[model samples]
Structures are given as C-alpha cells and as structure tokens.
Target: MFKIEVAKMSILFSPITIGGVSLKNRIVMSPMGMNACKAEDGKVTNWHKIHYPSRAVGQVGLIMVEATAVSLDGRTDPDDLGIWEDGQISGLKELVDMVHEQGAKIGIQLCHGGRKSKIPGKIMAPSAIPYDENSIVPEAMTEEEMYEVIAAFKESARRAKQAGFDVLELHAAHGYLINQFLSPLSNKRGDKYGGNLENRYQFLKEVIHEIHKVWDGALFVRISATDYHPEGCSIDDYIVYGSMMKEQGVHFIDCSSGWIVPPNFSERPGPGYQVPFASQMKKEVQIPTGAVGLITSGLQAEKILVEGHADLIFIGQELLRDPYWPKRAAKELNVSIDAPPSYEYIWNK
Candidate 1:
C-alpha cells in the first residue's frame, strides 16, 4: 500500500448500474479459462478458491468466471468448470461467497464448446463442419439435439442462480457453439436454424428465452463481433444480433472479435483493437456494451468510457498480470480509492 497525489475525478472509478445490479466500478475481469479443475469432473477446485477471491480482494468491480461448460460434452477442455449438475452448486457457491465477502460481484460465463470440445466423444455443431483442418469434423445437430443443448443451457442458468452468482453471461463468442450458429461461415444447414441471419440466430434466441424463465438478474452475452472473413459474420450482422439481444432483455454485450473459425487477419491485435465493435453496437443497438481485447492502462480504459465508446472495460490478461489492476488504475488516474482495513495503515500513508 502506498499514497499518491490526487487529481481530477476519474470515471473509471465511478459506480455504474446495469440491469438493476450496481457495480462499484466499470472494470470487468473478462473470463479467461484457467483449466485448473485438475479432476476433469468440472467441480470447483482449490485453484478456483485461490484464483478468484484474490481479484475480489484486489478490488475488481466484477469478476466473470471463465468459460464454464453447460454439459460434460460442451467442455472446451477436460478440466474446465461446469454448472451442468446440482452437485457443482455447492463448490460454486463457496467460491461466490468468498468473492462476495470481499465486496466484489461475480459472474459466470456459460459455454458450450461444440466442435472445440476436448472431451472424449463425438462433438455436435449446427453443421457438420470442422473448425479447421486439424479439428474434428463434428456431427450435425438435429432438431432434438438442438433442444437438448438449449435445455442444458437452461439448467446451467438455474444452477448458476442457485450457486449465488450476481450475473450470468452466455459464452457466444470465440467460435463456440453459439458463435458457430451465428456465423454463416460455419452454419450451412438448410433448415430453420440456417440460411438467413435471423435463422442462424434462432438457437441463441431460444436459449436466452429459456434462461430468462429462471434468471431475472443482469444477463450478458459475449459475442465475436466479427468473423474476420468476408464470407463470415460482419459488423453489420452483429449490429442486428445486438439489437435482438437488447430486445430480449440482455443487459450488456461483451464485445470481442474473431475466432469464429480460425485466424485470417494479417495484423496482430493492437491496444483497444475491439473497442470499435463495442462502440458500434452501443450506438446502433442503443445497448450498453463492454470493450475487450488488449485494453490496458487506466488512461486507455478511461478513454473508452469518456468517448462513449463503451460502458464497461473488460480486462483479461492485464488483470492476470496484476490482480491489483484497479489500484494501479486508480493511481494512474490520480483518484483515491479505499483499501481493505488490513492494508489501510500502509495505504493511508
């Protein structure tokens, strides 16, 4: 703990309310898979106990738990967390309680890896396409299979609520099952779940509908704003999806781009590379959005909010590097923030 000269008021340190849930600040810990379950059973483990609460203590306003499987076969990795069963609730509740005790809100990213699943079984996708040359060619999902997946998501949302999460995020990005359905590059079936953009959106629409039955809390949907290929989803397409999500009562859209299939970009990611997506969605859809991807530094995060480019700054790797990133941001912005009572002596000095 240390003291710094105060400057002007910082919007980065300002409180915000989304979907009736008030957060202490706008900084969100973007979900990043830890693969730490160790048992491959998807139960919360000792690693989760230590990893999540540390950030809460460090003062992150909202911590989104990593992509957690809705079903065993939906797991991105064998050891990824799960909310598919009642047995998982107790462990998850314990983790949520720890974070709440430290005065931070916690959310969980509900996901279905689809073709990307590492579990030892045949994976299912909207179409029978493989993610890439080396990836497995997934079985095309039938109507019954699609219903099963939606039910899985519904059940997962129930479990997440029972486990005491403050928010629920649908993992619709990064070429996962929902992304596969949303992007034309991967979905090619000639049914109601395919063809036009609205058709492709049918699956996610139903999932959201079912989840809303059990969850009336702040709901967020993470999306790959662009497929990065001309044949794939474009920004205009996501604008429509964003509008749909807004109408469906989604509180926020976590804007991230690419990985709908594979990387096709010529340039590497730069700072705030994905901020424009959030800006576009926010303006066009009239919905609050979170900008993710490579946004580091308090000034940079503040700039995004200041310009009305995004409502929330979703920090990923930066938070991993420094759990006390909120403190660093406060210091950089020259704004004073409260430290835990245990560290107040040194912080006040």
Candidate 2:
C-alpha cells in the first residue's frame, strides 16, 4: 500500500507508524495557537470540533492541538484550552472522536507557559525575566512549586488519556517552562535544575517520566532546534537535549526553532528554514523526527521526506488558508485521495 518513490519524491504520502500509532500519510497538522476556546473554564469547545475534524477530512495524518496548559497557572491565554480540570475532558473527548471518525489521529500538546504563563496576569518561570511587559513576571518556581508543576503535567496526561487522545505532545519548545530550563540566558539558577545541560534537562526528564506513566500512547516532544540567539540555546545544546529526550522514550522530535529568542543569522530563516535541524537530528541522533516551518508546497514537503530530511512534514498556515490543502496536493501530484461517493460532485475538479 506504500511505495517510497525516492526519485519521483512520493514518500510524503507514505504510511508510517509513530511509537505504535499508524498514520495514513506523513503529513501532520502542527499545533498553531488558535485561541478559539469558548468555554468559561477553557475546555475544548465546539470550535475545536470544527477546527480539527476539518483537517482530518482534509486527509492529514496527525492533527496536533495547540499548546494546552497542564495547569491553570500555566495557561498562556484565557482562551487557551486547559487539561488541569476533569471537566475539560469530555469536550476534548468529543473533539478527538470526531477527528478519529474522519480517519485521522489526534494529539494534545501539554504545556506550561512559565514566564510566558498568561494565566490572567500570573506567570511563573525558572527566573524573573519577563516574557513581555504586559506578560507576568512569573516568580521562579520553588522546589515545592516545581514538584507541583510536575504533578500537574502527570494529571494533565491522565486527563488527556481519559479524553481518548491518540498521542501526547510535550510542548518543551518556545521559551515556555521547559524552554526556560534549557536556556542559559533565561535560567540563572545555581541549583541542580539550572546550571548545565543535564541540570536544565532534569525538570523535563522528570515531567516526561510523570507523563509517560500516565500516557501509554506515543509521547512526542516539540523542541526549538535552535534558540536563534547567539547568547541563548544553541544547536550543540539542542542535539544533547534531543538525545536525552530520545532516551526518555520520546517517540518523535518535532523540529521547530527561534521562539525562545529572537531570530539570529545562525538560523537559516526562509521557507523550510528549520528542515536542516530535523535532518541533522535524524542523521545524528537516529530518532524519528518531524519537520515544521513554512512548509508550503507538496513538492517541497515531498523532497524533505524523499531525501530523508524528516520523517514527517507539518503544514500550518497553508492548511488554515486552504482546508483542502491535502486534496489540492493530491491533484497537483496526481495521487488518489479518499472521498465519499456522495461528495465526488463537490470535489475541486
């Protein structure tokens, strides 16, 4: 059922299994902050149902929900969905079910905003550096507080399971709680949680341990492959961190970059800017990885897979701008896609 036409570059449409979850194709719908939650307590809302099922109907392999706060205090926006409460599970369950019905797998991204924590006005970080003036200063988490956050992550994963999500994506990227731990420029603590790569990775490793116990599903981790700042997290550090994450049973490293700091020349920014990061990680670390960043074309995405640059490609804005991106791609590349017999008349000819 799958042919890896390397020369014709058709591997992008091949089936692959991540951890134990099989994907219909290699295309993933990467998480983008929609901030569309409408429930008072920030539970997944009807908008989520509408948002994700459409992607599945469009034929993407994996649909990763936006950053979901593991704790109330960790929320990045009032509208951001939260897994901290059991009340939020059923709505999300409905959303996941809808996606599955469309023959798509759904993953929920668990996150802690740290200094970027946009819980009302409260933010908590590894240090006091502000994410924005309007953003909360976020008192450094004490050991007790840190432990609480870890528990929070575990509980969130438990809730996600109860919601019937297929995967758990740890949002360790973008200068959030986990990113704060990894960045020397952000983490100034002299404690075991801050000084070196091992120390910086400690909190995340433990969080993974916690979530891992509760989530029997594939556990994917998103990483900023480059800090994009000369003084910040580096490619060297990223590889070290990726190796540690792999040892922790992370199923795939979703390659992303530059949210922890401003863009730097070190980051080769443009279309497919972050593909090299995924390529290098897969080559050196030998772990399954996903490439995401301005991936806009069927051929462009296919080349990444054909050349072994990434195991998966995610289309963000492109899909949003055109919910039928998959169908269009199928047509462009002369590939067949599944559509119910009733809808054949409605397909873009």
Candidate 3:
C-alpha cells in the first residue's frame, strides 16, 4: 500500500519569534488610530474591549493596539488612547488581559503627534513648518522640550510593561514627531538634531535609548521607509536607518511609507506595495521587518513570507472590515487555525 503525506501549512500561519517573544503565527494587526477611547480622556473604553479581543478570537497571532500617545499633548485627536499617565494603566491592563485570554499577544505603538496633533493646542516638531497650508506652523522643539518628549516615551514604556504588553512599538512613521526629525523634507534644523542624516537620526536614537532603560520586552520601530518626494528619505536611507535601529537593540522594523510630508508624486498602492521596503531592510540591514500597506489576502501574505520579502504580515483596514480575517485567511490558504472553543463548532461546520 502507498501512503501520501500532506504538505505543511503556509508560512503565513507558522510560528515565529522576535525579541525573545514567541508568537503563535506571523500575522500582526497593524496599529491604526481608532479614536475610540473613553470620553476623550485618553482612556480605553468598551469599544476597545470588543474591537481587540475579537481579532484574537478570530486567530490573529498578534494585535498591535492603535497609536497611543505618550503625552497628553502628543495625542493626534481628543479621543486617542494614551499611555502617558499611571491612571490609564488599569484600563489598558484590562484590555491586555482580554487579548491574552484569547491567545493573542498585544503590543502598543507609542507615539507623539507633533505637528499632526489636532487637539487645539500648539504642536511640536523638529522644524517650524506646517504640514500643509491649512495647518498651523508648529513650534520647533527646543533642546529642553526634546528631552521632555524622550522622557515621556521612557515613562510610557514603563507604563506599558505595567499594563502587561508583550511588545512595544515606537511610532516613528507617518510624519509624526520622530518622522519629522527623520525626513529631510520636514526637518530643516542646522544643529546636531538635523542637517545630515546622522544628525537627523539622533532624536530617534535618543528616544530609543531612553525607552531601552525601561522596556525589556520586544521593541519594534515603525518607520516611514520612504517619503515619495525627492527631498525625503529614500530606500537606501532607510537601510542605514534600519541598521541604526538594529544597533539600538530594536527587534523589528515595521516597514511603511509616505506622510513625512505630502508627496509630490501620487502613489498607486496595491497588494504588497510596501513589501519591497521590508525586503530591502531585511536584506541590507540584516534585521527582521514587518510589512504593512495594502496587503489584503492570506495567499498574498504567504507569498511574501515564502519569498523572504518580510518576516511578519501586518494587516490593517482589512482586519477592521472582518475581525475574523485570520480565520478566513486560514481557510483560504488551506491551513487550520485554532478558534475560540465556543466558535469551534461554527468554524468546523
């Protein structure tokens, strides 16, 4: 009698580890601003309670909660979640416990809105430029103010640990404060915090240095790998940035693009449009990368992993559209994913 052996599952559904943390699979829900916190006080609400754990129940390996402000003034909007104060810890801890109970790991993206803040106050930036004609010119951060923001990140990291997060991501992307320092199009300082690329990297390097003092868990940096303008950071520049981050003990580079300033050229985004950024970072910088941007299907995600383009697949808007995207992806990819005990019967049938 002849026997046939079945092929193993897709790498998209395979387990991988980063920064000493083990995830059951490689699917990471990208951090998107939800603006759903309680009463605009920067606290998690029941909306988060339902929003996050449902993805875990749907079998997403990891869920990165939205970009959370590291300081009250750092918030992008009034309703954004925050980690700036101790009072917010209990609410976050409750959410963490819920995600963990559903067998998913959780991470929080620590951010400062900088010039992008819409909370009716003076925003801060590396330079005093407005993001657009409609926006106000932000105060270029003084040396003292820069130190304060760095300290805020460190304190927030400590609060995240207290809240029991498995990972912490620094939001250095999408034209935020850190991205403002990173991109030439936005940062025009002549000091050590700007001018050359090394100087431009100093702010983020210092921020990470301070965060390292408190965060011992998985540390990831989400970066806008390109600004899509001639004056902005290029892929080659990100290779250098990725290397610097790796030296700082960063475990993963979440590859994304644009928003450093408005692009001169239009972006024609489609499936895996940003995977090349991740692939280049992994190849040249020798660090793991999480690919985000327009990646929508499990088969597409699987191909990316199989081809060594990226180490993790970050699903964004798609996850919001269908909380069970992971389980559905499993079915589409002809792999099996463990569902919640209560949902097993439904999935099985």
Candidate 4:
C-alpha cells in the first residue's frame, strides 16, 4: 500500500462543487444494486435504510443509491427499488433523510432494464434482440412507447426532487434501455430512433431534457464507455455523447465500461483500468468525470485526481468490504477527517 508523508496533503479529501451542490470531499460511494427489496413491490425496504446511512456514518462524501427502476416494467430485477409511483416517494424520502442526517449527500440512479430485465412478461427494447443466446428476445418499442418511457423518467425525476435527493443520475450504461438505443449492435431501428449515431442518441437526449424540466439539482449520467466489439461504440463515440450531455447541462459523467454484452475478458482488469475513459472524457469533452472500477486505495484515487484524470473517485466493492473506507483512506494519505460524534474519542485520537 502507498502512503503519503505527514507533511503533505491529499487532494482526495478536498471539496468541490458540481451544479451548485458542494460535496464534503472528492470521494463518492458508487451505486451498486443489492436487489434487497424482499417484497418485490419496487418500494424501499429496511435494507436500503440501513445500507446507505452506514456509509454516511463512515464519512463517504456522497452516497449514490443503486439502480432504481423508473417504471414497473423497466426493473432489472423483481426486487429492485422503484420510483415509478407516488406511493414509493415516502419510503425514498426516509432513505434520503437518513443519509442526510449522517452528513452525506445522497443520489439515486434512475434506470430502465430494457431487454435485460429478469421480470416476466414481454420486455421492450429499441430492437427485437436478446442480450445473448440464453436471454429472451425483447419486442421492438414503438415511437409511442418511447414517449411513454420518457414521461416515466420525467415523473421519476419529480419524485426524486420531492424525496429531497441532492443528485439524480440517469443510468445509460450496462446495455440497459438507453444503452440498447445507443449501441448500433442492438438498436436496429430504421426510423428516427436508430440507424445512425445521431438517431441512436435521441432517446437519451430526450430523457435528459425531460428530467431537466422537473429536476434543477445536480444531474449525472453513467455510461458504458466501450462495448468491447469492433462494431460497437468506442471512446470516440462517447466523446461525442459526452459533449452532447455537457450541452444539456449534465454535471458529471460517471465513466464505466463494458457489460454492453456478455463478459469476454481478454485479460484480468487491473486497478484504474477504466480511469483512462474518465480522463479522456474530462479532457476532450471538458466535463467533470468520476473514475470507477477497481480503484481501491487512497494513493491510487489521489494519483488519478492529482494527474487530472478524473474529478471524483467513485468507490464500489471496496466500500462494501469496509464502510469506514474513507477513514482508512485518510490514514493512508496522512490526512485527518472528522468522525461521527459517537466515535470522537477513538477517531480523534
């Protein structure tokens, strides 16, 4: 493990503002779906209430909730959290309040599963395609259906605002609904929604536009930077998409790659393997970016920020292994951070 001397400071502990919201530090708890809503009714559960606030108590700067379905049919799993109806707002509000009480800002990732949904019944996508040979083929969405999905997103944004969320993220990655539309490999539509880059981008563009109408807070987008196929989207394509998102007032691009299809890893990924994608977007598109994937240590995260590769450090599985990761990171970097009041004696020492 790398460590900094006591005389030096760590940039990872610094504060930065995006879209008028100031974070306590540069560390963010990346969203990871737990699928813990045991009732399977798309409502927040006891697990969500405990899971998110624990990170806040651990001192993470920002906590991003898992992929929440924007519509009932859009859920990736039967038990995923939802923001579809007004009834779900109260539960979400409770989760948000709990996180805020512990001094951490919370955000939610609004998502649609498209063809990848594990729920029963007919699923929809830009084309009648299956994610893989074992996956069921989804029906092609009509223009009217697309408009309905957009409306669902808009309504979900309104619900997010009502629930007092500090940030809202549209999940456009991981071969989901918006991703299926963006990727030429899955989006075979001949009409306005497909066939070319501009056409493919229309679905996400409209989702952002509609969400902005209701949400004035920080807006973020998580995207799959590459498809790992020669015929699929590459870094060059995301540069264009990143520029478009910037134009639409997106605050940050959460850069994550692959999973647009089944795993075909040529080699095992190393730490910061996906940092290059965030770095490229930050430099080329000139928008704030969050680097994720295998970033585990304070030194590694700090180096990425110090080199101007990304604006934020998004931690996933690491935070799960240790909720007090920020505290651990502070020690590694020779910095001090305020601990929760109850733990003052131990932490302050």
Superposed model 2: Cα runs more than 4 Å off: 1-9, 132-135, 264-268, 346-349
Better of 3 and 4 by TM-score: 4
Q: What is the number of backbone collisions in each predicted candidate, taken in the order shown?
A: 0, 1, 0, 0
Each candidate's root-mean-square deviation in Å?
2.7, 3.0, 3.4, 1.2
Span of 10 residues, lowest total lDDT, candidate 4: 1-10
Please give, for residues 1-349, the per-residue lDDT of candidate 3 as tens digits.
2112224687888899999999999999999888887645899999999999999988899999999999999988888999999999999999999999999999999999999998877789999999999998999989999999999999999999999999999999999989999999889998899999999999999999998999899999999999988778998998998999999999999999888777565546767789999999999999999998888887778878888989999999999899999887777777787878998888887
lDDT of 1 by residue, 232-324 (tens): 998899999999999999999999988977796788888888999999999999999999998889888888888899999999999899999
Candidate 4 accuracy as lDDT: 0.93
- Stretches of candidate 3 exceeding 4 Å from the true structure: 1-6, 38-40, 264-267
Question: lDDT per residue, candidate 2, 91-154, as tens digits?
Answer: 8899998999989899999998888765565567888777655654668779998999999999
* Top of the candidates by TM-score: 4
Clashes of 1: 0
TM-score of each: 0.97, 0.94, 0.97, 0.98
Q: Which lDDT tens digits does candidate 4 get at residues 1-349?
A: 5443433567899888998889999999999999997545888889888899999999999999999999989999998899999999999999999999999999999999999999988799999989999999899999999999999999999999999999999999999999999999899999988988988999999999999899999999999999999999999999999999999999999999987788688899988899999999999999999999999998888888888999999999999999999999888788889999999999988
Q: On TM-score, who's better, 1 or 3?
A: 1
lDDT of each: 0.92, 0.84, 0.91, 0.93
Backbone clash pairs for candidate 3 read none
Per-residue lDDT, model 3, residue 155, is: 100
Q: Ten residues in a row with the worst lDDT in model 3?
A: 1-10
Please name the candidate that would achieve the greatest lDDT relative to the true structure: 4
